[model samples]
Target: MSSTALIFHIQRFSIHDGPGIRTTVFFKGCSLSCFWCHNPEGRHAYSEIQFVASNCIGCGECVYVCEHHAHQLKDGERFYSRALCVNCGKCAQNCFSGTLELIGKRMTVKQVMDEILRDSAFYESSNGGITLSGGEPCLKSVFIRTLLEQCKQQNIHTALETCGNYKWDKLNSLLPFTDLVMMDIKLMNPDKHKQVTGDSNKRIITNARQLVLTDKPIIFRTPIVPTVNDTIEEFSEIVDFIEELIELRLKRGKASTNDANIQLELLPFHQLASDKYKHLGQDYKAAQLIPPASEKMHELAEIAKKHAIDVKVR
Candidate 1:
């Protein structure tokens, strides 16, 4: 049988994902469950039903269409009974009002390639291509490798946005076809990282160390969460770590100070995905936290700059 992956979303014409314009394919499943994760729907490995209550309009369409009686209208409000749902996608198919929706679907490599190839003209004009994002794209290593290989066959530039929390062997297999790797370093402290993200930093740090050794360009990103991993001390430690990695590269004659193969991008925290949490029937733990002001982002950028590394606030 042809290999297929469970994917949550395919965002097109995206400027923030990579250079110029790009299409970001969000794969389902992840190793970590960070409290502030924006895409709660993407975390689960299996397909999930996302119920948007406000959009239902107390419509009985889902109840009528679902053969399993997974949906019920209770006192002018809609409720989705998870126990009865077989994930047949029947209710979602008839959901014209956009209340009940399936979050993930299986897609073959060829099927995904066709979707991205449709925007070939845009990619050519803007010097952009396909980017595999997640729920940790590396989780589905074989599927991602095949997709990356296919993209390369078509001369499409490929990038991977990862949290850097996967097995080293899995990542090594994908880099040969990847042109750029944008990884997130959520926290410098191992214990704190484990506390918030529910995973230790050992694996992520190790993977990144090996990733930089490769020829592909690397972009180190961090979502600056206030009172979590955002502190002057934390940023200083991060810069020091990057400086050490650059030294290692120089020692091996793999990179130079002027090479610009590595860069840092600080992503400000945002509450934009709070509603997504509600839709996914999950709590938005960071609801009260506001996005860091531009000035604050710049202030941290200055700290990163002091290490003589190219840094930007995105």
Candidate 2:
């Protein structure tokens, strides 16, 4: 069989992913189970259906097409039973209002490149290119490397958004073709990190140390979720760690004052993706948590700025 990847979405004209307007290719299958993950649909590797209850008009359109009896109308209301569904995409195919939809699609590098090339003009104009994000792109290492190689051949700028929890061998192979690396550092405390994200921070920290040794410019991100790395002291500790990496790069002569290749971005957590859990039949863990205030995010940004590194809040 040929190389195939389960891609969930292709977000076009994205700004926050990297510099300028870009197209973000979201891959499926994540190793971590972050409780506050905004993109829960990407956690699984297989193709699944996402149900948007609000969009369902109870028109019984899906009921007629689903051979597995995954969809039914009860008292003029649509009732979806995921247990019987085999994910053949028959019901989702008939969903016009996007009430029942498929999340992941199997595609090859050439197929995905067709979509990326469509926005080449926008990328060149905005100094933006293709960004591989999502359910941890590194989990699909070989396939990602192939796709990145194709992008390099086409002279398309490439970036990888990763969780940095995988084995180094997997990520090291893709680094050559990647232009920029965006990695998340949600929590510093190992115990707390495992509790929230369902994985230890040991591999993450080790991988980060290795990333600093390379010449690749990296942006280590921390999503400021309330009750989780949102305090000033904890944030400061993370900044201190980043400062250490910067110092290492400088000591090794890989960077100077002008070309400091390290940056810290503080991302504020929100409950906007609560519906994503409802769609995927999972609990919204960040449901009870509130987003930090704008002033607080700025305060944290200022704290990080005290160190000799770049700090951004969003």
Candidate 3:
């Protein structure tokens, strides 16, 4: 098993990811290409350089330092060629304007634990712990398992933020160390799911069914995208699935979601990551999609509440 993985960021004191304040380890790489993904940098499985044109000062320092001619100044404007860039990071290192950035870093379990131990006290006090989030943390399952093993040894609560597209065995092994599981159920129709996320929902739904049998806490999340799955009928299909899962757990003599062990969280889409897409030289195809108003979220939450499970709009 590999001990190191490509990590992009470690966000400390994160309140929204899990039960309490958490230290979220953001890994690089994903299986899905959700149109409204906030972390476009995490999409690639390898390290990448991000350039923000608006942040450029036209200092030509990057042009002066680039070895591959990736950075060029033509018509008094700086241009970056992703095809020519080799990710040596020399130009990013030399650029003084913070315009260029290397997004991913290779981290060992030991190195990551050093950072997690920093907030041990907060974890103990707030019921918060370590949450592994990513492009898809399971993409580096072996590495995540090692890191999560370290977390469990420390008696810290462990959680996962996954897309549920991996094979059942891949995720099953990590559940022993995970105290909570947060998986996305973006779309119900397999074809529609493939249309938006670039993958069929077959494996995801299979995982969800298997996950329901386990006693581990689970949170099913559906991001509310405007033109994608905003309708009551569409959203209700997801809620109906959750209700069925709760029934499945009850049949197995496990705690149902009604007892708070399982729940649904609705996340509204936002353009906060618009600039992130720009930085990554990728277009935000969902740019024109408007955010659902607060009242709309409340309405959806109410629609979800019609089921036996607890529903909350985040």
Best by TM-score: 3
lDDT, candidate 3, 66-179, per-residue tens:
889998999986789999998878888888888898889998888999999999999999999999998999999988898999899999999999999989999999999999
lDDT of 3: 0.90
Ranking by lDDT: 3, 2, 1
Clashing residue pairs found in predicted model 1: none
Error of 1 at 245 (Å): 1.3
lDDT for every model? 0.87, 0.88, 0.90
lDDT by residue (47-139, candidate 2, tens digit) is 899998989877788999989988889877668888998888888888899888888999988899999999999988999999999899999
Clashing pairs in 2: none
Q: Where is the poorest 10-residue window by lDDT in model 1?
A: 249-258
TM-score of each: 0.96, 0.96, 0.96
Model 1, 1-314: lDDT tens digits are: 69999999999899999987899999999999988887887899888888887777765878988889888887876678878988778888888778878999999998999899989888889999999998989999999999999999989999999998978999999999999999998888999899999999999999888876777788999889887767899878888888877776666675567584888899999888988898877778889887889998999999988889889898
* Candidate 1: segments with Cα more than 4 A from true spot: none
C-alpha displacement of 276 in model 3, angstroms? 0.6
What are the C-alpha RMSDs, in order, of all predicted structures?
1.5, 1.5, 1.5
Looking at candidate 2, the ten consecutive residues that score lowest on lDDT are 252-261
